[model samples]
Target: MMRVLVTGAGGFVGKHLVSELKNRNYEVIAAASSSREDAAAGKLHGLDITDLAAVKAFIGRTRPDTIFHLAAQSNVMKAWHHPSAAVTVNTVGSLHLLQAIQEVCPGSRMINVGSGDEYGLAGKQGMPLSEETACQPQNPYAVSKFAAGQLVLQMAKKNNLQAIHVRAFNHFGPGQEEGFAVSDFSSQIASIEKGLLSPVIRVGDLSAQRDFTYISDIIAAYVALVETDVPNGVYNVCSSIPRMISTVLEHLVQMSDVDIRIETDVAKLRPSEVPIFVGASGLLEQVTGWKPKTVFLDGLERTLDWWRSRVGL
Candidate 1:
């Protein structure tokens, strides 16, 4: 069995990836920055990726052949509110991990998870974003991710580390936190279903369009990338088709049994939010022969159902 270490193993994506890896008979070791309780049953280790000495020590001890770097401060609005903290976690923490890997597991392979936010305003170009697009990060989150991605590539080239980068777009499903749009919408619906709140669904800017993929598809992309013999570089993990936020909200409303009215609250809107972010993931498809298989409506239904179950609906 291949020894695989997953950082941020307690997170939504990380949990799903770990499950898939375990099913495939991989010797999975999950590392959580906080507590390893979630992965404790699965024999996880607690090690903060930001802690350089701890990271080095852990890598030295376990010596995984493949490391999935997923730990990061991923709140966009929070990043705007706390730029320095975001930089420290997203960039500096990644540097710590890279250095540790170099010292203890020099021959190991790595996958650095980045965000579509790195493209920032470049998504406004109105074309399906390709890997060749020049990044123009508008916010602290994007800037930090872009810088970290650059560092990954630089380290791979300069130090001969087997590293690959993946820029994943908006993904949602079960286990997603409430701050995300899909989870927020589902939670509101769950509440409305249970008579906990009014029929009005509060939301941010509904005009913005996004490429939303199911969490399973995102995990499948990662699995394919790791399993394939593709060369080392960046590839997008996203659905090429983009849908308007208004359309998505309408669909969610249609799925519900209760009557709901769309209400916009300025407080919910993101500052400097990109209007549209559609990515062309041809590079990933070409390399791994993998494409998003989940339909948007089906994915949304599953997400709403998961929230409904969680809320006892």
Candidate 2:
């Protein structure tokens, strides 16, 4: 079995990716940003990508066949609040990983997981953003991720290392925490149903449309990149179909058992948010034969169901 190392293994996407990789028969070494004690307890191996020496020593010791660098301070609002911390973890941390991989295991393939938010202002250029689009990262999170991806690609080219930077768009499903559109809507609806909160669903700019892929489909795209011989540089993982946030919340509310009222929450609104954000997956499909399988409506229903079950409805 091929040995694989996944950073940020305890996170939402990281956890799902680790499970999928293990299911596919790869020897997965789940390295979380924290949880080193878990390693002694037969759990996640702790790894702090921010520490250069630690990263180099770990890479030299394991020499994994592939490294999925998923560690990141992915929360936009949090990154906005703590810009320096975001840069430290996302950019500088990724730099540490790149240097360690280059010095210790130059042959190992690296998949640097990035965000579609990196195409910040470019979303205004056109709909269905592609890999060729110039990135204009608006927020700290986007800036950090873009810098991280750029570093991996540039270092890989110079060092002749096999590396891929994946710009994954909005994705959601069961077990997704709040602070995102779908999960927030689903959680509020569930809470309303369970009578834990009022029958009001507070929301932000629901008119803005975004590309969303189910979590399983997103995981499949990552697996495809690993299994296939994809060329270096960046690739986008997304569903080209654009769904307005209003429609998303509407569908989730429809799935709810209780009567709910939509309330515009000024606190939930983001500043200078793009009206529409979507991405094309033609390149990913053409190369790895990976395309989104779940319909948008179905994914929403599944997410609502998951929330419902969690809230005891």
Candidate 3:
């Protein structure tokens, strides 16, 4: 059994990835920054990537055959308020992991998870962003991810490490936090259905378009990358089709049993929004033979159902 270590194992994507790995019969270690009780309940090992010595010690002890680095400060709005913290966690933390891996497990393969936000305003030039597209990270979060991704690429080139950088776009599903748009919308609708809130759904910039992939599809891509003998490089994991936020909200509303109206919330809007963001997965498909399998509406409905069940609607 090949041993694999997953960072951020308590996160939405991390949990899903860990489950998939277990299902595939890999010897898996779930690492998280959670308390002892929470880690025990989730079957995770407490490991904080920000602490260099701790990361090195963990890597030395586990000696995983492969590692999925998914831990980071992922909230965009939160990054705006705490840019320094975001950079420290995303960039320096990633450096710690990379260094630890080089020293303790030189043969270990690594998957460095990055964000599509690295493309920034460049998406305005066309429909689907390619890996060749120049990165113009506009926000602190994006900047941090971009910097970290660059470091991964450089290390892969210089150190002979089998590391692949992946830029994931908007992905949502059950267990996602309330801050993301899809989760927020689903939660609000579920609350309204349960009579916990008004029929009005508060939203940010609904006109902004994004390529939203189901969490399962995203995880499938990750698994494919792990199983394939692909070269070291950056690949975009996303649906090529861009859908407006308004369309997604409308679909969610239609799925709900109750009548609801959309309301623009200035408070929810970003300081600067990318009007359009999407990515082409041709490279990923070519390398790993992976493509998104879920329909957009079906994924949305499933997410809504999960939220409904959570709120007892």
Candidate 4:
């Protein structure tokens, strides 16, 4: 079995990725950013990704054949408010991981997880965003991811490490952080169902469009990429289909049996937010013969059901 180390294993995507990895018979070494109890049972390593010494130590100790660098401060709004911390954790932390891989597991394949936000407003004209698209990151988080992605490519080319960068679009499902739009909407709806909150669902920028993929589909893509003999390059992991937030909200509202009022929250709106973000997974499909299978409406219903079950509805 192949041995893999997944950073940020406690995170939403990380946890799901680790689970998928283990299910595929890969020995997983899960590394979390904090000392919290791991969500999945594995060789857990609690070490901050931003710490260079700690990262190097873990890589040396684990000696994984593959490193999935998924740990980072990914919230755009949070990165906007705390740019320095975002840079430190996302960019600098990624550099530390690369350095560790170079020093310890010199021949390891590294999958540097990146974001679709790295495209910024370039894909707003309804064209499918591709790996060839030039990165014009607007937010601090996007900037950080772009920088780390660039660094990964540059270092991989220079040092001969099997490093590939993956730019994943908006993915949502259970265990997602509450700060994201999907989770927030689901949580609010769950609260309404539980009588913990009013029937009002506070939202922002419902007109914006996103290429949302279910977490399981996203995890399957990750697993496929790992299994495939994909060359060291950048590829997008996303649903080619993009839908407006209004459409998603409409479906969610329809799925809910209760009357829910929609109210716009001024605080939720961000200046210079990308109105539409979409990506094409053509390269991934060509290489791995995988495409996202979950429909947007179906995924939304599943998410709603998850929140409902969690809130005891």
Model 1 lDDT on a 0 to 1 scale: 0.86
lDDT of 1 by residue, 28-83 (tens): 98988765467322545788777789889989999998889898899989999999
Give the per-residue lDDT digits (tens) of candidate 3, residues 1-313.
Answer: 9898999888899989988998999999998886443432268788888899999999999999899999999999999999999999999888888899888889998899999999998987766899999999989999999999899779878988888889999999988979888998999999999999999987766787889999999999999987899898999999998888899999999998899998889898773356778898999999889999999999999999999999853
Model 4, 113-232: lDDT tens per residue? 999989987876668899999888888999999999899889988999888999999899988858777887887888887889888887766887888889999999888878888899
Best by lDDT: 3
Residue pair clashes in candidate 4: none
Predicted candidate 2 versus true structure: per-residue lDDT over 1-313, tens digit per residue: 8999999888788888888887888988888866654322136877888899999999998889999988888999999999999999999998898899889988899999999999998998557899999999999999999999998899889989898999999999987888898898898888888889999877776788889999999999999988999999899999998888898888888877788999899997874367888998999999999999987788888888888888853
Q: Model 1: runs farther than 4 Å from truth?
A: 39-41, 265-273
Error of 2 at 139 (Å): 0.6
Candidate RMSDs in order: 1.9, 2.3, 2.0, 2.0
**How much lDDT does each candidate structure score?**
0.86, 0.88, 0.89, 0.86
Residue 213 Cα positional deviation in candidate 2, in Å, after optimal superposition: 0.5
When summed lDDT is taken over every stretch of 10 residues in candidate 3, the lowest stretch is 34-43
With candidate 3 superimposed using the best TM-score fit, by how many Å does residue 147's alpha carbon deviate from the native?
0.5
Runs of candidate 4 with Cα error greater than 4 angstroms are 41-43, 263-273
